[model samples]
Structures are given as C-alpha cells and as structure tokens.
Target chain A: MLVYLIRRIGQSIMVVAVMATLVFLAVFAVGDPVAILASPDADQRELEAITTRLGLDRPIYEQFGIFVWNALQGDLGRSFVYAQPAVDVILQRFPATMELALAALILSILLGVPLGVIAGLKPESLLGRSIMTTSIFGFSLPNFWLGLMLILLFAVQLRWLPASGRGETVEVFGVHLSLFTWDGLRHLFLPALTLSLYKASLVIRIAQAGTREVMLQDYVRFARAKGLSYNRIVFVHVLKNMMIPVVTVLGLELGSMIAFAVVTETVFAYPGMGKLLIDSINRLDRPVIVAYLMLTVVIFVIINLVVDLLYAAIDPRVRLTESKG
Target chain B: MSKAVLDVKDLSVSFRTREGLVTAVNSISFSVGAGEVLGLVGESGSGKSVTGLAVLGLIDPPGEIDPRSSIKINERELIGLPEEKLRRVRGKDVAMIFQDPMTTLNPVLRIDTQMIEAIRAHEKISEKAARERARQALEKVGIPSADERLKAYPGQFSGGMRQRVAIATALLNRPTVLVADEPTTALDVTIQAQILSEVQQLCSETGTALVWITHDLSVVAGLADRVAVMYAGRIVEEGPVSAVLEAPIHPYAAGLIGSVPSRNKRGVPLAQIRGMTPSLTNLPPGCPFAPRCDYATDICRSTMPEPTPYEGGRAARCHHPLSAPTPAAA
Candidate 1:
C-alpha cells in the first residue's frame, strides 16, 4: 500500500510540474502585465524602471528560471493588483469557495442518491418516473439561468433569502466560515443550490443507472433469498455496490468545483478563489493566474490520488490488484 | 415416504413483454418429501429456472405467477402469500441458490458477513452467535479452515469454493426447502461433481426438500431420487430417476437421455433431439414439443396432452407414449 501511494505521489508531481510550465509560459504569452499595471500617463523611463523592478526587463526564460526557483521556495510573485503574495491572496478567499462547494456537494449527494436508488428500484412507479423527469431538467437547465431564477424567486419576490454576498462569517482557527450560522446559511442558499443543481442531476442519473444494474446482480437476489429485510438489501447490498462509481465521480468533481465555480461566485459575489482568479485574469495579473493554476493542478492530483485510494477501499477487486502489484 | 415438505401444483409463470405475455412456465405439478432431492431437468428456456424462482416468490415485475397456481411449504400455502409473510418464510422455511456461484456471493462482502446475515435474518441471534453458526455452516460444506475462510471475500475463493460458500449460506437456517437453480453449471466438471454430492449429502442429512434445477440429466441421475423433465414450459415426464432415464415414455425425455454424452449412447446420431425448444411467444396450436418429437402425429400435433400416469407411478404427457417395442402404436 505504501509503495502504491508513493507511486501515485510521483505521478502527481509530474502532473503539477507540467501544469506549472504550461501556465507560466502561457501567462507570458498573454497581454503585457506592465501595461495593465503602470499608469498610461507615466513617462517611458518611469515605465522602464517599473518593468525592471518587476523582473520583466529580463528575457522570458531567465525570468521563468527565477520564478521556478522562487516557487520551489514557496514564493509565487506578488499580485500586480493586490500587491500581496499571489499565494497568500488566494489563501484568504479559499475558505469561502471551499464552504460553498462542500455545501453544494453534500446537498446533492444527500438528496440525489436516495432519490436515484428509489427510481431504480421502482423504475415504473409514478414517483420514480417523476424523479427521473426532474433529473433530466436538472441536467438541461443552465446553471447561470438557474442561479438568476433562484435569486429572482427566493430573494427578489419571496423575500426569503439573501440574493448576493457571503453574509455574516465567524472565524475559527484563522479560517472564515459562513456555513455555521443559520443567517449565513440563509444568505448562502441561492448560489450553493444553483451550483449543486447540475451535480445533483448528474448524481441522480449515475446513482440510478448504477442501482438498476446492481439490483439485477445475482448476489442481490441471493440476499433476498436469504430473507434479508428490504431495507438491508437496498442499503447494504444495493447502495454499497452502487456507490463505487459515485465516489469516483464525486471525488474528481471536488477539484473542478473549487477551480471553476467562477460563474456562481460572480452571481452571488461570494469571496472565493474562483472570483479572485477571474478578476486577476481580466486585469492580466500573471503572478496570480500562474499561482492559481498551479495550485489547481496540485489539488487535482491530490483528489485523484485520494479517489484512487477510496476506490481500492470500496472494491475488493481493486484492493486485491493493488496488494498484488 | 416421508411427508411432502414442498408441494407445488399447477404452477405457471408468465412475463409481459412487448411481444405479449410470454408463458415461461406452463401449469406443472410436483412434490418432494423431506430429505428428498427432485431434479428438475430441462433445456434452456424450458422453464426450469423460472420454476425455482417462482417457488421462492422471487419473480418480480413484468413476470406474474398464475393465481390458479398453488405452492405449499410444509402444508402452509405460499402462493399469493403477502411479500412480508413470504419474506419470513424465505431463509427460514425455504431458501434458493442461483447458478454462477461466482456472482451468488456478494463480492464486496466477506464470507462471514454474508453467512452471519443469513442466520441473523431468520433468528434473533447476536452477531457472535451468528458468526459461530456461520463458521459451522462453512465447515458443514467442507470448506477448509472454515473460521479463517469466513474473514475473506468471495473473490478470494476459487470458483468451486465460492459455490460451496453460497451453499453453506443457503443451508445456514436449515430451511425446510432448498431450491437450487443450475448451481453447478458454471463449475468445472470435478468441482461440479463434488458440489453435487456435497449438496446431496447436506440436504438429506438435514432432511431438507431439495429441488435441483438443471439441464444436465446425468447430474440428476446421480444426485436426485426423482426427476421431472421439462420441455417448453411443461413437465413432459417424471418418475424415479432410473425409471425415467431407462424408459422415458415421453419422446422428448428419451431424446434428452439419448443426447447425454455417454459411451453407451455414442455412435447413435439417431438418438439426438432434432430441433430447438420452441419460442414461447408464438407456440404451435397443440403440443409445444410436437415439432421436435419423432412420434408427433395428427392428434399429437393438433391436441395438447394432459399428464397421464403409467405403471409404478411414472407419468408422461404424450398421446403415443414411447415403448421399447410398440408394433401396434404410431
């Protein structure tokens, strides 16, 4: 097991390195950071002095070498806009996005799996058919439109929820968390629900398909023959088997949610890394973009490794192969 | 004879498909006394497996059991029994084992978990007591180091060993009736024979009524006291194993015995059954097996024959029952 983990970590390092190189070079190829930063009224000499100070006067390769060396020492260059270490700027907004993504994910799973399993077990029932129909709408409806509609209904018309902003936050262990308070949750409801809509639909379809297939397995019938209660058979025999793929899909989805929940963040004005990354991109803030992309690569690698381990733990077939290797 | 532990009468099952209601098991009746193994032999789609599933009330939506059919376990009516009531009966009075032992045991679960659950489902036993019984059940099926083997998953065991685990689980509650559907079909020859005898010994020792469903007549010959041969959803012939195999009054049964690859039947191409089992969706006007029976004639083709009794309690469904030398018969 240790050997397998080490091998995975090795592969992850390679993935992170490739992503770092690509993002670094791509950032350089884009719009001038100096132009975006220095004022238009500044004299040419003043502009040259700013460029030299920022290490942009050197050739791209020399600058990249220096950046790589500094990054190795945990120093991504300071953000042009915030004038703070790019990594530190990202860290400050991390909790907001993490909480939102986690809220959405947990909500989707708690709702989707049971509904999907029910639909699968009784695919012909009226309730089951309706569950499936709702999931179809869940998949087809755009998240942005869904977000706006939710804001319009619950916030604007119903006056039940806050439409935008991260409401009140309580700090714990130097981390900002809005999810603990009822008022904060009320504020968070619209955007989190909007982000979760697509995932909930996906989970429903995956769980339904998986449950249907597992329900037909010989062991499931055997379990029934053993006089296992309907609940036991459905939960232990059916759900456990169906969860393997769900875990796989959900684990990989975590990274994507943290990295790409920009639209939802924008709509709600949630202070998350996604919003920070987007603002930096628009301002041509190379240091921030490069740091964010590299961090995303690290997160993806970690999630993939964690998912692989979880897969092995859930499936004895995979576990056997791992031990053998 | 011991009292009949399982009595099935006029049992029929059908599946509602797009084509129409496909009759999978036509009306059939049979019984097995305590400690008796009755082999239900048939070709694929001849309703052999369907009968096994029907006995346990495992037939789900799209498939319906005929209301006219009656299944009794130990003189207790089972047909049309509420699902909750039937569930109590399952793994307590009656249990079923399916083909493909590789899949019969849940791959994700350990052998002990599966067996313990089987015992706990029927009894108010604690986990420790259930685990101890599971260990004994494994030993009863002749699995080596039963206690240790229980901790392992089904994937850890060999194919034959896996089937033994499934059998051990089925027998955990000492069910009055054990319905096995082609339990040995997926196993290798040696393993099949071993499991066959082990199961036979286990059932007789426990006084369980065993309905062994298989297409292998030879397996029935060795393991069953009586045999019922099905052809296109009906039992065409049934009698003591020797009586049915030696003198199959039904032509279809004769063809089946002849087709068994034995040294005695070798070099006899004439003995092989000529055609496939008929499709249930669009069957002939009369006997379902008429197209394949050599003695099929005007009456045989035009009229379906009800099961008729012969000497020594043997029975066959045929207008012209085959005889060794019937000079006067068609």
Candidate 2:
C-alpha cells in the first residue's frame, strides 16, 4: 500500500509539472510580451526600462525558470494590468467563484441524481418520461443563456432578488459581515442557478444512464429475487454501483466549473477568478494570466487526486491495485 | 411426493416494443416439488431466464404479465403482488443466482456489506449476527478464508470465487425456492462441476426447490431430478431427467440431445441441429420449431401440437412424435 501510494504521488508530481509547462507555454504563445509595454506615449528608454523590469529582456528559458521559481515560492509577481500582486488578485476574487461553483455543484447533485434515478427506474412512467425530456432540454440550453433567462424571470419580472453583485449591504448578527461568505451567497443565487442548470442536466443524464445500466446488472436481479424493497434496491444497491461513472463525471465537471463559469461570470458582472482571468487576457496581463492558469491547473489536478482517493474508498479493487503497484 | 414449493401456472409475459407486443414467455405451467432440482434448459432467448425472473416479480415495466398469470410459492400467490409485499417474498421465500457472477455481486461493495444487506433485508438481525451468517454462508460455499474474503470486493475475487460468493448470498436466507440461472456458465469446466455438485448437494440437504436454468444438458442431467426443454417461449418437452435424456420424444428435444458432442462415440461425427429457432417476432405459422425440425411435415408445419404425455413420466409436443428415422447407434 505504501509503495502504491508513493507511485501515485510520483505520477501526480509529473502530471503537475506537465500542466505547469503547458500553462507557461500557453501564456507566452499568444502574442509578443514587449508590445503591451510599448505604447504611443512611451519613448525608447521607457520601453527598455519596462521590458527590463518585467524580465522580458532575458532569454525565454530564463524568464520561464524565474516564473516557475517565483510561482513555487508563493510569489506570483505583479499583474501587468491591475498593478497588484497576482496572488493577491486571485485570492481576492477566488472565494466568490468558489462559492458560486460549490452551490451549483451541490444543487446539481441534490436535484439531478434523484430525478435521474427515478427516470431510469421507470422509463415508461409519465413522470419519468417528462423528467427525461426536460433534462434533455436542460442539457441543450447553454449556461449563459440559462443565466439570462433566470435574470429575466427572477430578477426583472419577480424582483424577488438583486440582479447581480454580492448584495447591496452585508451584515450578520447585528454586525457588518464580510462580502466573502454571507453576502457572496446572497448575490450568487442567480448566476449559481444558471450554472447549475446545465450541470444538473449533465448529472441527471449520467446518473440516469448509470442507474439504468446498474439496474440491468445481474446482481440487481439477484437483489430483487432476495426480496429487497424497491426503494432499497434502487437507493442502496443500484445507486452504489452507479456512482463509479457518476463520480468520474462529477469530478471532471467540478474541474471544468471554474473554466466553464467564464461566460456566466461575464454575464453577471461577478468578481471571480474566471472574470479576472478573462480581463487579464483582454489586457495581455501575462503575470495574472499565468497565475490564474496555474491555479486552474492546480485545481484540476487536486480535484482529480481527491476523486482518485474517493474511488479507492468506494472500491477496494482500486485500492488493491494501487497497493500492488 | 413432497408438496409443491413453487407452482407456476399459465404464466405469460410480453414486451411493448416499437414493433409490437412481442411475447417473451407464453402460457407455461410447471411446479417444483420441495427438495427437487428442476432443470430448465434452453438456448438464448428461450424465455427460461424470463420465466425465472417472472417467478420473483422482477420483470421490469413495459413488459406486462398476463393478469391470469399465477405463481405460488408455498401456496402463496406472488403474481400481481405490490412491490413492497413482493420484496418480502423475494430473497426470503424465493431467491435467484444470475448467470454472470461478476455482475451478480455489486462491484463497489465488499462481500460482507452485500451479504449482510441481503440477510438484514428480510430479518431483524444484529450486524454481528449478520456478519457471522455471511461468513458461515461463504464458508458453506467452499470458499477458503471466508471471513477475509467477506471484506474483499467482488472484483478482488476470481470468476469462480465470485460465483461462490453469489451462491453463498442466495443460500444465506435458506429460501424455499432457489433459482440459479446459468450460475456456473461463466466459470471454468472444473469450477463449474464443483459449483454444480455443491449446489445440488446444498439444495437436497436443505430441501430447497432448486431450478437450475442452463443450456448445458449434461450438467443438468447429472444435477436435476426433472428437466424441462423450452423452445422459443414454451416448454416443448419435460420429464424425469433419465427419461428425457435416454429417450426424447419431441423432435426439438431429440435434436438437442443429439447435438451434445459427448453423446457421440469416438470417431463418429457430431450431430448438429439443422436450423436456428424461429424469431419470437414474426414466428412461422403453427409450431415454433417447425422451420428448424428436419422431421417436420405438412401437419407439423400447419398445427402447433399440445404437450402430450408419454409413458414412464415423459411428455412431448409433436404431431408425428414417433416417425423420425433413428440415427446411427452410438
């Protein structure tokens, strides 16, 4: 087991290295770094100074080495556009996006899985068929479009909630609350719901297909023959078997949530890493772009690792294989 | 004879597909006496597994069972029972072991979790007791280190071991009726033989009415007390194992018996069934096997014969049952 874990950790390090290299290349590959510094008002000396200060005057390899070293040492350099520390900029904006994505994920799992399971168990029933058809529509509708629809219906028509931002004012327990937690959740509802619409459909389809496949398995038949209640069979036996593929989808979806939330974030005018990354890209903010890209890579790798661990917990066979290797 | 443990009468099932309502199991009647292993032999889509599934009320929706279909276990009608009540009957009074052992056991769960779940599903047993019974059941099925194996996942075990675990699960409740649908089909020959003998012994010892559904005639011949030959959706022939194997009266049965490679002596060419069974949808007029049977005549092709009793506890469904020319002697 120890040997297996060591191997997996070794593989994880390699994967992270590959991801870092890719992010570095992608950030630099888009356009000339010196062009942004060269403006109509800037003279030759100013251009040289800006280039030297930003380390663009050095060899590409040296620049990349410096970037990696500083990134590893918790120094993400300064944003070219924001003129603030890239790490600070990311940290300031990350919580809002995280809160929104987390809410969306939770809602998807809560609403989509059960609906999918019901649809799969009774494919011919009116409720089941209706749920399936609605899920298909849900999947086809884009997140940004869904966000717009929610804004139109709930924000414009109903006036029940604010259209955007973390809320007008923040207070908790008769005290001024932080925008990161309570206020963020209040303002995040519409965008989160929009984000959840597509994700919920995905989760439903995956869960439904998975549950359907599991239901057809011989063991399910065995369980039925054993006189296990329909509820027990569906929830206990079928759900457990169906979770393998569902977990895989959920994990990938979670990783993609940070990236996929770009359009939704833009629509809501929300302050998140996704919005920060997009703004940085538009202004050719290399440092902030690289930092955000690295963070996205980290999130993807970390979530996948957590999912692998979850897989191990769910199935001893995977654990055994890990141990054996 | 002992009292009938499972009495299935006029059981029929049909699926509402895009094409039409395709009949999977026609009105078939059979009874399994307590402590007797009735072998249900058929090829793929012969409705053998469907019949077994129907008995437990496990048939999914869109596949409708005839209202007249009646399945009684220990004189209790199971057909049309609500899902809640049916759950109590299944795995308690009647349990099934499916064909693929790998899929029969939940892949993600440990043997202990699955087995104990099965045990506690019907009984109000403590976890400790359930665990102990699971271990005992595994041991009973000849699995070495049963306690250790209980903690292992289904994928951790070999195919044969998984089948043993599945069998152990079925026997955990000491069900009155045990339906094993090609349980040993996925195992190696030696493992299949071992499992077959073990199941046969367990059934007889516990007085459980066993229905061993398989395509292997030889396996059933050695294990079952009585055998039923299903063709398409109906039982074309049924009788004592000895009577059916030694002298099959039905043309399909004779063809099936002749097709067994082992039945031929050394240096003799193996006999093969001439044609495939007719499709369930758009079946030929009259007999389902008429298109396949070489001995089928105008009368055989025009009229489906009802199952007629033969001497010495045997039955056959054929218009000219005794008219076939004898094959070269073995």
Candidate 3:
C-alpha cells in the first residue's frame, strides 16, 4: 500500500508537469508577448523597458522556468489587469464557484440516482418510460438554455427569488448581518440551480444506463432468485455494482461543472471563478489566466484521485488488488 | 405420499415486444413431492429457465404472467403474492441457484456480506451469528477454508468454486424447494459431477424438493428421481428418469435422448435433431416443434397434442411416437 501510494504520487507529479507545460505553451502560442506588453503608441525605449520588466524579453524557456519556480513557491505573479497577486484574486473568487459546483454535484446525485434506479428497475412501466423520456430531453437541453429558463420562470415570473446577486441582506440571531455574508448565499441559488439541472440530467442518464446494465448481470438475477425484494435487488445489489462507471462519469462531470458554470454565471451575473476566468481572458490578464488554468487543472486531478479512492472504497476487489500491488 | 412441496398448474408466461405478445412458457402443469428431484430438461428457448424464474416470481418487466396461471407451494398460492411476502418466501422456503457462478454472485460484495444479508432478510440474527451460519453453509458446499473464503469476492474464486458458493448461499436458509437452473453447464465435466453428487447428497439429507433444470439429459438421468422434458415452452414428455431415458415417447424427447453422444455406437453416426427451435414470436398454429419433427404429418402440423399418459406414470405429447425397434446389443 505504501509502495502504491508512492508510485501514484510519482505519477501525479509527471502528470502535473505535463499539464503545466501544455497550459503554458497553449497560452503563449496564441499571440506575441511583446505585442501585449508594448502598444503601438508607446515609445520604442519605453516598449523595450515594459517587455523587459514583464520578463517577455527573456528566453521562453527561462520565463517558463521562473514561472514554474514561482508557482511551486506559491507565487502566481501579479495580475496583468488588476495589478494584484493572481493567487489572491483567484482564491477570493474560488469559494463561490466551489460552493456552486459542490451543491450541484450533491443535488444531482441525490435526485438523479434514485430517479435512474426507478426507471431502470421497471423499464417498461409508465413511470419508468416517462422518466426515461424526460431525462433524455433534460440531457439534450443546453445548460445555458436551462439556466435562462429557470431564471425566467422562478425569478422573472414568480418573483420569489432575487433575479441576481447573492442576497439583499444578511441576518444572524435575528440581527441584520453584513452584505458580504448575506448576499453570497442569496445570489448562489439561481446559478446553482441552473448548473444543477444539466448536471442532474447527465448523472441520471449515466446512472440509468449503469443500473440497467447491472440489473441484467447474473448476480442481480441471483439476488432475485434468493427472494430479495425488488427494492433490495435494485438498490442494494444493482446500484452498488453500477456505481463504478457512474462514479467515473460523475468525476468527469464534476470537473466540467466549472467550465460549464461560465455560461451559467454570466447569465445570472454571479461572481464566480468561471466569470473571473472569462474576464481575465477578455482583458488578457496573463497572470490571472495562468493562475485560473493551473487551479482548474489541479482541481480536475484531485477530483479524479478522489474518485479513484472512492472506487477502492466501494469495491473491495479493487482495494485488495491495488493494495497487493 | 408426502405433501407436494411445489404445485405449478397451467402456468404461462409471455413477453410484450414490438412484434406481439410472445408466449415463452405455455400452460405447464407439474408438481414436486417432498425430497424428490424433478429434472426439467430442454434445449435453449424451451422455457425451462423461464418456468423456474416464474415460480420464484422473479420475472421482471416486459414479461407478464398470465392471470390464469397458478403456482402453489405447500398448498399456498404463490402467484400474484405481494413482493414483500414473496421475498420472505424466497431463500427461506424456496431458493434458486442460476448458471454461471461469476454472474450469480455480486462481484462487488464479499461472500460474507451477501450470505449474511440473505440470512438476515428472513431471520432476525446478529451479523456475527449470520457469518457463522454462512461459514457453515460454505463448508457444507465443500469450499476449502470456508471461513477465510467468506471475505473473498466472487471474482477471486474459480468457476466451480463460485458455483459452490452460490449453491451454499441457496441452501443457507434450508429452503424446502431448491431450483438449480443449469447450475453445472458452465462447469467442466469433473467439477459438474462433483457438484451434482454434492447436491444429491444435500437433497437426500435435507429432504428438499430439488428442481434441477438442464439441457443435459444424461446428467438429469443420473441426478433426478423424475424427469420432465420441455420443448418450445411446453412439457412434451415426463416420467421416472429410467423410463424417460430408455423409452421416450415424444418425438422431440426421443430425438433429444438419441442426440446424446454417449448413447451413439462408435461405428454409427450420432442421431441429430434437424432444424432449430421455432421463434416464440412466430410459433405455428399447432405444435411448436412440428416443423422440426421428421414424423410431422399434416394432422401433427394442424393440431397440438396434450400430455397423454402411457403406462408407469409416464406421459408424452405426440400423436405418433416411434414404435420400439429391435434393441441393439449394448
């Protein structure tokens, strides 16, 4: 087990290195760094000074080395647009996006899995067919479109929820709290819901497929023959076996949630890392962009690792063999 | 006679498909007495497995049981019983082991967890007690180091070992009726014989009514007390094992017995059943096997025969059974 852990950690470093290199190359390949550093109106000497100051005048390899070194030392450089530390800016906005993604993931599993199980357990029944049809439509609908629909229906039509922003105000212990604390959660709802709808549909489809596959497996038939209740067979035997593939899809979907949240955040006027990343891109905020890309990559890797751990937990076969090796 | 352990009367099952409602198991009537091994033999798609599944009320959606069909265990009707009650009856009163041990045991779970769950489902017992009983059951099925093996997953065991685990699980509850659906088909001949002997011993010791469903007539001839031969969703021939094997009256049954390789002499070619079993979706108006029967006459093609008794508790469903020819020296 210790050997396996060390091997996995070694592999992770190589993976991160590759990820960093690719991200660096892709970002730089789009345009000349000198052009961004120096505008046409700038004097030649001043342009050269700016290029040198920003390290653009240095060799690409040297610049990359410095960037990697600084990143490892927890310095993400200064934001090109905001003139603040890129790490600080990204960290500040990350919580909102994290909360949204987490909520969306939790909600999706809670709702989608049971729905999928029900549909799979009785594929030809009326309720099962209806769930199948609706989930298909749900999966096909665009996240942005679904977001707008939710906002239009709940915010514009019903006037129940605030259309935008986290909240109007906050209160604790019957005392009014500050805007920063109060407004965050109020604004989080619509955006989270918008993101969750599409995610839930994807999860439902995956779970449904996995459940159906597991249901047809011999063990499930054996469980049935043992006189296990339909509910027990479906939930205990079928659902547990089906989770491996569902977890894989869910892990990938969780990573994509941040990418998908950009559109959703934009639609809701929510301040999340997705929106921050997009704004950084539009403004050519190189430091902020680099910071966001690396953070996203790290999160993706972590989610996959966590999913692997979960696979081990849920399946003893994986655990035993993996431990042995 | 001892009370019938299982009484299946006029049971029919059909599946709803785009083409039409296709009957998989026609009206089949049979009963198993206590401690009797009633072998249900048939080729693929003969509805033997379907019949076993139907008895357990395990048929899922797309398949529906005909309301007219009734299955009684110990004189209590099992058809249309609430799922909760059926679950209680399953494993406890009646249990079934399926073919393919790898597929039969949940791969993700340990044998202990699965067996304990089965034991606790019908009985209120501590996990410790259940585990102990599970170990005993595994030992009874002849698994090596049974206690250690309970912690192992289904994949860790070989095909024969897994089937033994499955059989152990089925017998864990000491069910009165045990239905093994082609349990040995997935095994090699040596392991098959071993498991068969183990099952026969277990059945006689417990006096459990064993329903051994298989396509192998030879296996059933040795293992079963009585035999029922099914063809195209109906029982065509049934009698004592010796009677059915030695003097099969149904043409399909005769063909089946003749097709067994061991029965063929070295100099002569083996007898073969020509043509495939008809699709359930497009069954003929009369006998489902008529098109495949060499002795199929115009009347045989137009009308199906019901189970008609011959002497010695034997029955056959054929208008013209082949008369006994001069016996060849063994």
TM-score per model over all chains: 0.97, 0.90, 0.90
* Ten residues in sequence with the least summed lDDT for candidate 1 chain A: A183-192
Q: List, residue by residue over A23-105, the lDDT tens digit for candidate 2.
A: 88887888865676578788889889988988888887998899889878988789876679988888777766877788888
> Comparing to the true complex, what docking class would candidate 2 get?
medium
Tens digits of per-residue lDDT, candidate 1, A25-97, equal 9889998878878898999998999899888999988999999999999999998888899999999998999
| Per-residue lDDT of candidate 3, residues B1-330 (tens digit) | 367889999999999999999889999999999899999999999999999999888887689999899998888899889888988898988999998876888988888989988998888899999999999999998998988999888878999999999998999888889999999999999999999999999988898999999999889989998999998899998888997788778889889989888734886888899999999998898888889888899988899887777767777788787654322233
Candidate 1, chain B, TM-score (2 decimals)? 0.96
The list of candidate 3 runs beyond 4 A from truth reads: A1-4, A30-42, A136-149, A167-183, A320-325, B285-288, B294-298, B323-330
Q: Give the best candidate by DockQ.
A: 1
Q: What is each model's TM-score for chain A?
A: 0.98, 0.91, 0.89
Model 1 regions more than 4 Å off? B265-271, B324-330
Worst 10 residues of 2 chain B by lDDT: B321-330
Which of candidates 1 and 3 is the stronger one according to DockQ?
1
Docking class of 1: high
Q: What value does the lDDT take at residue B53 in candidate 2?
A: 87
Q: CA shift at B123, candidate 3, in angstroms?
A: 2.2
Task: State the TM-score for model 1.
Answer: 0.97
Q: lDDT of model 3 at residue A63?
A: 84
Candidate maximizing TM-score = 1
